[model samples]
Target: MRVAVLPCCLFSLAALAGCATGSKTSEVAQVRMVFPVQAPARPQCDAKPLERLALTGQVASQELIDQALHDSRAAHARVMRDDHVADASINPARLNLRVSVDNRIISSSCG
Candidate 1:
């Protein structure tokens, strides 16, 4: 059985060798496959601009908040009282504004 196996392998190798030996040079074949990838949509909901507006320590003016919301590119804006319980849900395209009891803007963020 071992002798038979050896002859079979040698025959296969010789047959393969003959397929390439007659040529001056053997050329290698290369196959390449490319897949198209799509990038995910990213929402711009940064709070830096809103924070800057709040740094004034004054009341959150409607005009200023509106401009900040527009600049932050948030689809919607929600204003919450500092002591009030706000919705804990996340919204990437929404701006959240927390105001103090005296109407001063305390914190600004995006959820």
Candidate 2:
């Protein structure tokens, strides 16, 4: 009877220890999978045109701007000074037009 009881006690303790260790490992793995690491920020000046439009260095016309805006599918469109264009927010669904004082399009970009 004593021998049998000793073996049973040892086996129970081992099973408990194994379960505790396994649960900890699984919890850590779950946390790592649920939380993702962030990537590096992209450059601000790397904007690209959403559609093919001959806008750069051209006279800014309402018709041309409207066409460009339509093609871009931007949620917001704004005509800003050429100098202020660099400071504009680059949004995937936004379009920015850098125009000179004479209403000529100096540059255009989309995110």
Top-scoring candidate (TM-score): 1
lDDT of 1 by residue, 10-60 (tens): 999999898777552433221112444569877768877665554346677
lDDT of each: 0.77, 0.73
Candidate 2, superposed: residue stretches over 4 Å from native: 1-51, 83-88
| Model 2 lDDT, residue 70, Cα | 71
**True lDDT of residue 15, candidate 2:** 100
Structure candidate 2, residue pairs in collision: none
True lDDT of residue 76, candidate 1: 80
- Per-residue lDDT for 67-97 in model 2, tens only? 7777765655677886553553557756678
Taking all chains together, the TM-score of candidate 1 against the true structure is: 0.56
List of clashing residue pairs for candidate 1: none
lDDT of 2: 0.73
